[model samples]
Target: MVQSVKPNPQGGITVTCDNKEEHFDKVIFTSPLNVLTKVADSSLFESSKPKTPVEYLGVICLVLITKSSLTPYYVLNIADKEIPFTGVIGMSSLVDLDQTGDEHLTYFPKYVSANDSYWKKSDEELKSLFLEGVSKLYPDFDTNDIVSAHLHKAFKVQPLQVLNYSEIIPDVQTKHKDFYVLNTSQFVNDTLNNNSVVNHVEKFVNEFKTESNLQ
Candidate 1:
Protein backbone atom coordinates (compact mmCIF):
# COMPACT_ATOMS: atom_id res chain seq x y z
CA MET A 1 0.00 0.00 0.00
CA VAL A 2 1.15 3.58 -0.67
CA GLN A 3 2.18 5.50 2.41
CA SER A 4 -0.01 8.37 3.49
CA VAL A 5 0.84 11.85 4.77
CA LYS A 6 -0.60 12.79 8.13
CA PRO A 7 -2.21 16.10 9.20
CA ASN A 8 -0.14 19.22 9.99
CA PRO A 9 -0.32 18.47 13.72
CA GLN A 10 1.87 15.38 13.14
CA GLY A 11 4.56 17.51 11.39
CA GLY A 12 6.18 14.41 9.80
CA ILE A 13 5.40 11.77 7.19
CA THR A 14 5.94 8.02 7.33
CA VAL A 15 7.00 6.10 4.23
CA THR A 16 7.16 2.31 4.29
CA CYS A 17 8.75 0.24 1.55
CA ASP A 18 9.33 -3.54 1.64
CA ASN A 19 8.97 -3.45 5.47
CA LYS A 20 11.64 -0.77 5.82
CA GLU A 21 10.87 2.60 7.36
CA GLU A 22 12.56 5.88 6.48
CA HIS A 23 11.94 9.48 7.50
CA PHE A 24 12.54 12.54 5.42
CA ASP A 25 11.61 16.24 5.49
CA LYS A 26 11.36 16.49 1.74
CA VAL A 27 10.93 14.22 -1.27
CA ILE A 28 11.21 14.67 -5.03
CA PHE A 29 8.86 12.40 -6.96
CA THR A 30 10.30 11.18 -10.28
CA SER A 31 7.88 8.43 -11.18
CA PRO A 32 6.22 8.54 -14.59
CA LEU A 33 2.85 10.31 -14.72
CA ASN A 34 1.16 7.06 -15.66
CA VAL A 35 2.67 5.22 -12.68
CA LEU A 36 2.11 8.06 -10.22
CA THR A 37 -1.62 7.91 -10.92
CA LYS A 38 -1.73 4.35 -9.59
CA VAL A 39 -0.40 5.61 -6.23
CA ALA A 40 -2.74 6.51 -3.40
CA ASP A 41 -4.06 10.00 -2.77
CA SER A 42 -1.55 12.44 -1.31
CA SER A 43 -3.04 15.46 0.47
CA LEU A 44 0.53 16.52 1.37
CA PHE A 45 0.77 18.12 -2.07
CA GLU A 46 -1.39 18.93 -5.04
CA SER A 47 0.44 18.55 -8.33
CA SER A 48 -1.14 18.17 -11.73
CA LYS A 49 0.61 15.66 -13.90
CA PRO A 50 -0.83 15.28 -17.36
CA LYS A 51 -0.98 12.07 -19.35
CA THR A 52 1.71 11.98 -22.03
CA PRO A 53 0.05 12.31 -25.43
CA VAL A 54 2.51 10.16 -27.31
CA GLU A 55 2.79 6.47 -28.14
CA TYR A 56 5.29 4.40 -30.11
CA LEU A 57 5.66 1.18 -32.01
CA GLY A 58 7.49 -1.56 -30.13
CA VAL A 59 10.10 -3.72 -31.89
CA ILE A 60 11.77 -7.09 -31.59
CA CYS A 61 14.96 -6.84 -33.69
CA LEU A 62 16.45 -10.00 -35.15
CA VAL A 63 20.21 -9.78 -35.54
CA LEU A 64 21.74 -11.66 -38.44
CA ILE A 65 25.35 -12.79 -38.78
CA THR A 66 27.22 -12.75 -42.07
CA LYS A 67 30.65 -14.00 -43.16
CA SER A 68 31.25 -10.70 -44.99
CA SER A 69 30.03 -7.33 -43.86
CA LEU A 70 26.76 -6.30 -45.51
CA THR A 71 27.32 -2.64 -46.29
CA PRO A 72 29.88 -0.02 -45.40
CA TYR A 73 26.87 2.22 -44.88
CA TYR A 74 25.76 1.80 -41.27
CA VAL A 75 22.06 1.76 -42.19
CA LEU A 76 20.13 0.29 -45.04
CA ASN A 77 17.16 2.61 -45.48
CA ILE A 78 14.34 0.19 -46.28
CA ALA A 79 12.29 2.56 -48.41
CA ASP A 80 8.85 0.90 -48.41
CA LYS A 81 7.63 -2.43 -47.29
CA GLU A 82 7.97 -5.55 -48.70
CA ILE A 83 8.54 -5.52 -44.87
CA PRO A 84 6.86 -4.04 -41.84
CA PHE A 85 7.89 -1.32 -39.34
CA THR A 86 10.77 0.72 -40.75
CA GLY A 87 14.38 0.26 -41.96
CA VAL A 88 17.24 -2.11 -41.17
CA ILE A 89 20.48 -1.26 -39.43
CA GLY A 90 23.71 -3.11 -40.10
CA MET A 91 24.93 -4.97 -37.00
CA SER A 92 28.39 -3.79 -37.93
CA SER A 93 26.99 -0.27 -38.01
CA LEU A 94 28.79 0.55 -34.79
CA VAL A 95 32.16 -0.80 -35.99
CA ASP A 96 34.38 1.01 -38.48
CA LEU A 97 33.35 -0.20 -41.91
CA ASP A 98 36.81 0.58 -43.40
CA GLN A 99 38.55 -1.93 -41.16
CA THR A 100 40.18 -4.95 -42.83
CA GLY A 101 37.83 -7.64 -41.57
CA ASP A 102 35.11 -10.04 -42.54
CA GLU A 103 31.68 -10.63 -41.01
CA HIS A 104 28.95 -8.06 -40.53
CA LEU A 105 26.21 -7.34 -38.03
CA THR A 106 22.72 -6.68 -39.35
CA TYR A 107 19.24 -6.68 -37.94
CA PHE A 108 15.83 -5.80 -39.27
CA PRO A 109 12.57 -4.40 -37.93
CA LYS A 110 10.97 -7.64 -36.81
CA TYR A 111 8.04 -6.06 -35.00
CA VAL A 112 5.54 -3.29 -35.57
CA SER A 113 2.68 -2.24 -33.32
CA ALA A 114 0.43 -1.42 -36.24
CA ASN A 115 1.28 -4.62 -38.12
CA ASP A 116 1.62 -6.91 -35.13
CA SER A 117 0.72 -10.26 -36.64
CA TYR A 118 4.30 -11.37 -36.00
CA TRP A 119 4.26 -10.72 -32.23
CA LYS A 120 1.41 -13.26 -32.00
CA LYS A 121 3.76 -15.92 -33.44
CA SER A 122 6.15 -18.12 -31.47
CA ASP A 123 9.81 -17.13 -31.06
CA GLU A 124 10.95 -19.74 -33.58
CA GLU A 125 8.23 -18.67 -36.00
CA LEU A 126 9.28 -15.03 -35.63
CA LYS A 127 12.90 -15.95 -36.31
CA SER A 128 11.98 -17.65 -39.58
CA LEU A 129 9.92 -14.65 -40.64
CA PHE A 130 12.80 -12.32 -39.78
CA LEU A 131 15.25 -14.38 -41.79
CA GLU A 132 12.87 -14.52 -44.72
CA GLY A 133 12.28 -10.74 -44.71
CA VAL A 134 15.99 -10.02 -44.36
CA SER A 135 16.69 -12.28 -47.30
CA LYS A 136 14.12 -10.44 -49.41
CA LEU A 137 15.65 -7.08 -48.51
CA TYR A 138 19.12 -8.40 -49.30
CA PRO A 139 18.66 -10.88 -52.12
CA ASP A 140 22.35 -11.85 -52.03
CA PHE A 141 21.95 -12.89 -48.41
CA ASP A 142 21.32 -16.60 -47.92
CA THR A 143 18.96 -17.56 -45.13
CA ASN A 144 21.29 -20.52 -44.31
CA ASP A 145 24.21 -18.08 -43.93
CA ILE A 146 22.61 -16.88 -40.70
CA VAL A 147 24.50 -19.23 -38.37
CA SER A 148 23.04 -17.56 -35.28
CA ALA A 149 20.11 -15.30 -34.51
CA HIS A 150 18.58 -13.60 -31.46
CA LEU A 151 15.56 -11.54 -30.53
CA HIS A 152 15.76 -8.12 -28.86
CA LYS A 153 12.49 -6.45 -27.95
CA ALA A 154 12.41 -2.77 -27.09
CA PHE A 155 9.34 -1.42 -25.29
CA LYS A 156 8.48 2.22 -25.99
CA VAL A 157 11.85 2.62 -27.73
CA GLN A 158 10.94 6.13 -28.86
CA PRO A 159 7.92 8.39 -28.73
CA LEU A 160 5.63 9.04 -31.62
CA GLN A 161 6.46 12.43 -33.11
CA VAL A 162 3.53 14.85 -33.07
CA LEU A 163 3.05 18.58 -33.25
CA ASN A 164 2.32 21.52 -30.87
CA TYR A 165 3.14 19.88 -27.51
CA SER A 166 4.26 23.03 -25.69
CA GLU A 167 0.89 23.72 -23.99
CA ILE A 168 0.55 20.28 -22.36
CA ILE A 169 3.65 19.89 -20.15
CA PRO A 170 3.73 22.29 -17.22
CA ASP A 171 6.61 23.81 -15.30
CA VAL A 172 8.58 21.44 -13.06
CA GLN A 173 7.79 23.40 -9.93
CA THR A 174 4.33 22.69 -8.58
CA LYS A 175 2.11 25.26 -6.86
CA HIS A 176 2.98 23.44 -3.61
CA LYS A 177 5.95 24.70 -1.60
CA ASP A 178 7.92 21.44 -1.43
CA PHE A 179 7.13 19.09 -4.30
CA TYR A 180 8.35 18.51 -7.85
CA VAL A 181 8.08 15.87 -10.56
CA LEU A 182 10.49 15.49 -13.45
CA ASN A 183 10.72 13.08 -16.35
CA THR A 184 11.71 12.74 -20.02
CA SER A 185 8.42 14.40 -21.06
CA GLN A 186 9.47 17.54 -19.21
CA PHE A 187 12.57 17.70 -21.40
CA VAL A 188 11.43 16.64 -24.86
CA ASN A 189 8.41 15.43 -26.75
CA ASP A 190 7.66 11.75 -26.15
CA THR A 191 11.41 11.34 -26.79
CA LEU A 192 14.06 13.30 -24.95
CA ASN A 193 15.74 16.21 -26.69
CA ASN A 194 19.35 17.05 -25.87
CA ASN A 195 19.25 20.82 -25.28
CA SER A 196 15.87 20.84 -23.53
CA VAL A 197 16.87 17.96 -21.20
CA VAL A 198 20.16 19.59 -20.31
CA ASN A 199 18.47 22.92 -19.66
CA HIS A 200 15.68 21.27 -17.65
CA VAL A 201 18.18 19.29 -15.55
CA GLU A 202 20.23 22.38 -14.74
CA LYS A 203 17.16 24.33 -13.75
CA PHE A 204 15.61 21.41 -11.86
CA VAL A 205 18.76 20.65 -9.84
CA ASN A 206 19.11 24.28 -8.94
CA GLU A 207 15.44 24.62 -8.02
CA PHE A 208 15.48 21.34 -6.07
CA LYS A 209 18.58 22.32 -4.13
CA THR A 210 17.15 25.72 -3.35
CA GLU A 211 13.89 24.20 -2.10
CA SER A 212 15.61 21.32 -0.27
CA ASN A 213 18.53 23.44 1.06
CA LEU A 214 21.24 21.15 -0.32
CA GLN A 215 25.02 21.56 -0.35
Candidate 2:
Protein backbone atom coordinates (compact mmCIF):
# COMPACT_ATOMS: atom_id res chain seq x y z
CA MET A 1 0.00 0.00 0.00
CA VAL A 2 1.17 3.56 -0.69
CA GLN A 3 2.12 5.38 2.53
CA SER A 4 2.83 8.91 1.31
CA VAL A 5 3.63 11.11 -1.70
CA LYS A 6 5.57 14.39 -1.47
CA PRO A 7 7.36 16.64 -3.93
CA ASN A 8 11.15 16.29 -3.78
CA PRO A 9 12.96 19.55 -3.07
CA GLN A 10 15.41 18.94 -5.93
CA GLY A 11 12.73 17.95 -8.53
CA GLY A 12 10.11 15.38 -9.41
CA ILE A 13 8.00 13.44 -6.89
CA THR A 14 8.85 10.80 -4.30
CA VAL A 15 6.37 8.05 -3.41
CA THR A 16 6.71 5.93 -0.31
CA CYS A 17 5.16 2.48 -0.66
CA ASP A 18 5.47 0.38 2.47
CA ASN A 19 9.18 0.56 3.44
CA LYS A 20 10.42 1.28 -0.09
CA GLU A 21 10.64 4.69 -1.75
CA GLU A 22 10.81 5.60 -5.44
CA HIS A 23 11.26 8.82 -7.38
CA PHE A 24 9.71 9.75 -10.71
CA ASP A 25 10.04 12.71 -13.03
CA LYS A 26 6.30 12.50 -13.68
CA VAL A 27 3.62 10.91 -11.53
CA ILE A 28 -0.01 10.41 -12.49
CA PHE A 29 -2.44 9.73 -9.68
CA THR A 30 -5.37 7.59 -10.89
CA SER A 31 -6.74 6.94 -7.43
CA PRO A 32 -10.09 8.24 -6.17
CA LEU A 33 -10.21 11.93 -5.18
CA ASN A 34 -10.65 11.25 -1.47
CA VAL A 35 -7.78 8.75 -1.44
CA LEU A 36 -5.37 11.09 -3.27
CA THR A 37 -6.01 13.83 -0.69
CA LYS A 38 -5.26 11.45 2.18
CA VAL A 39 -2.03 9.91 0.82
CA ALA A 40 -0.37 12.93 -0.78
CA ASP A 41 1.01 16.07 0.81
CA SER A 42 -1.73 18.73 0.96
CA SER A 43 0.83 21.49 0.28
CA LEU A 44 1.56 20.14 -3.21
CA PHE A 45 -2.03 20.62 -4.32
CA GLU A 46 -3.13 23.71 -2.37
CA SER A 47 -3.81 25.72 -5.53
CA SER A 48 -5.87 22.91 -7.10
CA LYS A 49 -8.10 22.24 -4.10
CA PRO A 50 -11.78 22.65 -4.80
CA LYS A 51 -13.80 25.36 -3.01
CA THR A 52 -16.01 22.53 -1.76
CA PRO A 53 -14.83 18.93 -1.61
CA VAL A 54 -16.66 16.70 -4.09
CA GLU A 55 -19.08 14.15 -2.68
CA TYR A 56 -19.27 10.48 -3.74
CA LEU A 57 -21.71 7.59 -3.52
CA GLY A 58 -20.69 4.09 -2.56
CA VAL A 59 -21.84 0.94 -4.41
CA ILE A 60 -22.68 -2.57 -3.30
CA CYS A 61 -22.88 -4.83 -6.34
CA LEU A 62 -24.17 -8.36 -6.30
CA VAL A 63 -23.38 -10.65 -9.23
CA LEU A 64 -25.40 -13.81 -9.69
CA ILE A 65 -24.98 -16.79 -12.00
CA THR A 66 -28.22 -18.53 -12.65
CA LYS A 67 -29.90 -21.13 -14.84
CA SER A 68 -32.40 -18.52 -16.11
CA SER A 69 -32.27 -14.90 -17.19
CA LEU A 70 -33.83 -12.20 -15.06
CA THR A 71 -34.93 -9.74 -17.74
CA PRO A 72 -34.76 -9.31 -21.51
CA TYR A 73 -33.31 -5.82 -21.36
CA TYR A 74 -29.63 -5.14 -20.67
CA VAL A 75 -30.40 -2.52 -18.03
CA LEU A 76 -33.35 -2.13 -15.65
CA ASN A 77 -33.37 1.14 -13.73
CA ILE A 78 -35.36 1.09 -10.50
CA ALA A 79 -36.81 4.47 -9.51
CA ASP A 80 -38.83 3.13 -6.59
CA LYS A 81 -37.30 4.27 -3.33
CA GLU A 82 -38.50 1.15 -1.58
CA ILE A 83 -36.36 -1.06 -3.79
CA PRO A 84 -33.11 -2.08 -2.13
CA PHE A 85 -30.94 -1.81 -5.27
CA THR A 86 -30.40 1.04 -7.69
CA GLY A 87 -30.56 -1.04 -10.87
CA VAL A 88 -30.17 -4.41 -12.51
CA ILE A 89 -27.76 -5.27 -15.30
CA GLY A 90 -28.41 -8.33 -17.42
CA MET A 91 -24.88 -9.25 -18.51
CA SER A 92 -26.18 -12.27 -20.42
CA SER A 93 -28.03 -9.92 -22.76
CA LEU A 94 -24.76 -8.46 -24.11
CA VAL A 95 -22.42 -11.41 -23.51
CA ASP A 96 -22.37 -14.69 -25.32
CA LEU A 97 -23.86 -17.58 -23.37
CA ASP A 98 -21.12 -19.95 -24.59
CA GLN A 99 -18.60 -17.95 -22.57
CA THR A 100 -20.64 -18.40 -19.41
CA GLY A 101 -21.39 -22.10 -19.88
CA ASP A 102 -24.93 -21.12 -20.95
CA GLU A 103 -25.56 -19.66 -17.53
CA HIS A 104 -27.34 -16.35 -16.97
CA LEU A 105 -25.30 -13.50 -15.51
CA THR A 106 -26.96 -10.60 -13.74
CA TYR A 107 -25.70 -7.70 -11.66
CA PHE A 108 -27.71 -5.93 -8.94
CA PRO A 109 -26.09 -2.68 -7.83
CA LYS A 110 -27.06 -0.46 -4.92
CA TYR A 111 -25.80 3.11 -4.54
CA VAL A 112 -25.76 4.36 -0.97
CA SER A 113 -23.87 6.54 1.44
CA ALA A 114 -20.69 5.23 3.09
CA ASN A 115 -22.43 5.50 6.46
CA ASP A 116 -25.65 3.79 5.29
CA SER A 117 -26.69 0.80 7.38
CA TYR A 118 -26.91 -1.39 4.25
CA TRP A 119 -23.20 -0.82 3.62
CA LYS A 120 -22.33 -2.40 6.98
CA LYS A 121 -24.41 -5.54 6.46
CA SER A 122 -22.72 -8.97 6.27
CA ASP A 123 -22.55 -10.86 2.98
CA GLU A 124 -25.24 -13.29 4.05
CA GLU A 125 -27.50 -10.47 5.18
CA LEU A 126 -27.02 -8.53 1.95
CA LYS A 127 -27.59 -11.63 -0.14
CA SER A 128 -30.88 -12.32 1.61
CA LEU A 129 -32.10 -8.77 1.32
CA PHE A 130 -31.07 -8.37 -2.32
CA LEU A 131 -32.48 -11.72 -3.33
CA GLU A 132 -35.75 -10.84 -1.65
CA GLY A 133 -35.87 -7.68 -3.73
CA VAL A 134 -35.24 -9.70 -6.88
CA SER A 135 -38.07 -12.04 -5.99
CA LYS A 136 -40.42 -9.07 -5.87
CA LEU A 137 -39.48 -8.29 -9.46
CA TYR A 138 -40.33 -11.78 -10.69
CA PRO A 139 -43.07 -13.60 -8.82
CA ASP A 140 -42.09 -16.95 -10.33
CA PHE A 141 -38.36 -16.52 -9.90
CA ASP A 142 -37.05 -19.59 -8.14
CA THR A 143 -34.15 -19.86 -5.72
CA ASN A 144 -33.24 -23.15 -7.41
CA ASP A 145 -32.43 -21.17 -10.58
CA ILE A 146 -29.63 -19.31 -8.81
CA VAL A 147 -26.35 -21.22 -9.23
CA SER A 148 -23.98 -18.87 -7.39
CA ALA A 149 -23.69 -15.38 -5.98
CA HIS A 150 -20.81 -12.91 -5.54
CA LEU A 151 -20.59 -9.56 -3.80
CA HIS A 152 -18.35 -6.58 -4.65
CA LYS A 153 -18.28 -3.18 -2.99
CA ALA A 154 -16.52 0.15 -3.57
CA PHE A 155 -16.62 2.94 -1.01
CA LYS A 156 -16.49 5.80 -3.52
CA VAL A 157 -17.12 4.59 -7.05
CA GLN A 158 -19.68 7.16 -8.19
CA PRO A 159 -19.51 10.94 -7.78
CA LEU A 160 -22.63 12.72 -6.54
CA GLN A 161 -23.22 15.12 -9.46
CA VAL A 162 -24.58 18.04 -7.55
CA LEU A 163 -25.54 21.37 -9.13
CA ASN A 164 -22.67 23.13 -10.97
CA TYR A 165 -20.57 20.03 -10.43
CA SER A 166 -18.15 20.94 -13.21
CA GLU A 167 -17.14 24.15 -11.43
CA ILE A 168 -15.81 22.22 -8.43
CA ILE A 169 -14.28 19.33 -10.41
CA PRO A 170 -10.46 19.29 -10.19
CA ASP A 171 -8.30 19.70 -13.26
CA VAL A 172 -6.05 16.91 -14.50
CA GLN A 173 -2.99 19.16 -14.23
CA THR A 174 -1.75 20.32 -10.85
CA LYS A 175 0.53 23.07 -9.45
CA HIS A 176 3.39 20.62 -8.91
CA LYS A 177 5.35 20.37 -12.14
CA ASP A 178 5.12 16.93 -13.76
CA PHE A 179 2.58 15.85 -11.10
CA TYR A 180 -0.93 15.16 -12.39
CA VAL A 181 -4.20 13.52 -11.45
CA LEU A 182 -6.47 11.60 -13.84
CA ASN A 183 -9.50 10.24 -12.05
CA THR A 184 -13.25 9.75 -12.33
CA SER A 185 -13.80 13.06 -10.50
CA GLN A 186 -12.82 14.73 -13.78
CA PHE A 187 -15.82 13.00 -15.43
CA VAL A 188 -18.32 15.79 -14.87
CA ASN A 189 -20.54 16.05 -17.95
CA ASP A 190 -21.12 12.36 -18.50
CA THR A 191 -22.47 9.48 -16.47
CA LEU A 192 -20.14 7.17 -14.56
CA ASN A 193 -19.68 4.25 -16.96
CA ASN A 194 -16.92 2.33 -18.72
CA ASN A 195 -17.12 4.53 -21.84
CA SER A 196 -16.78 7.74 -19.82
CA VAL A 197 -13.72 6.38 -18.00
CA VAL A 198 -12.07 5.34 -21.28
CA ASN A 199 -12.81 8.73 -22.82
CA HIS A 200 -11.24 10.56 -19.87
CA VAL A 201 -8.12 8.35 -20.06
CA GLU A 202 -7.73 9.02 -23.79
CA LYS A 203 -8.19 12.76 -23.28
CA PHE A 204 -5.57 12.84 -20.51
CA VAL A 205 -3.10 10.78 -22.55
CA ASN A 206 -3.38 13.11 -25.54
CA GLU A 207 -3.02 16.23 -23.40
CA PHE A 208 -0.06 14.82 -21.46
CA LYS A 209 1.69 13.63 -24.62
CA THR A 210 1.31 17.05 -26.24
CA GLU A 211 2.72 18.73 -23.12
CA SER A 212 5.62 16.28 -23.00
CA ASN A 213 6.54 17.05 -26.63
CA LEU A 214 6.73 20.79 -25.90
CA GLN A 215 9.36 20.26 -23.17
Model 1, 97: alpha-carbon shift in Å? 8.8
Question: Relative to the true structure, how large is the alpha-carbon lDDT of every model?
Answer: 0.58, 0.85
Q: Model 2: per-residue lDDT, tens digit, 1-215?
A: 99898998889999999979999898998788778878988756753668788888889988999998988989888988767898999999999999999999999999898689987799889988888888887779998999999988888877888999989976544678768887777776798776778888888899999999998
Q: Which stretches of candidate 2 lie over 4 Å from their true place?
A: 5-27, 41-47, 175-179, 206-215
Q: How far is candidate 1 from the true structure (C-alpha RMSD, Å)?
A: 6.8
Worst lDDT window (10 residues) for model 2? 42-51
Q: Which candidate leads the pack in TM-score?
A: 2
TM-score (all chains, Cα) for each model: 0.56, 0.77
Candidate 2 — which pairs collide?
A: none
Candidate 1 lDDT tens digits, 1-215: 44432223334444555656555555555654444444423554454554464454567888766667556666565656666435677657677645525566776764366456766778787777767776676788666666567877765443444566655554444433444556665545433534566787799898777856763
Worst 10 residues of 1 by lDDT: 3-12
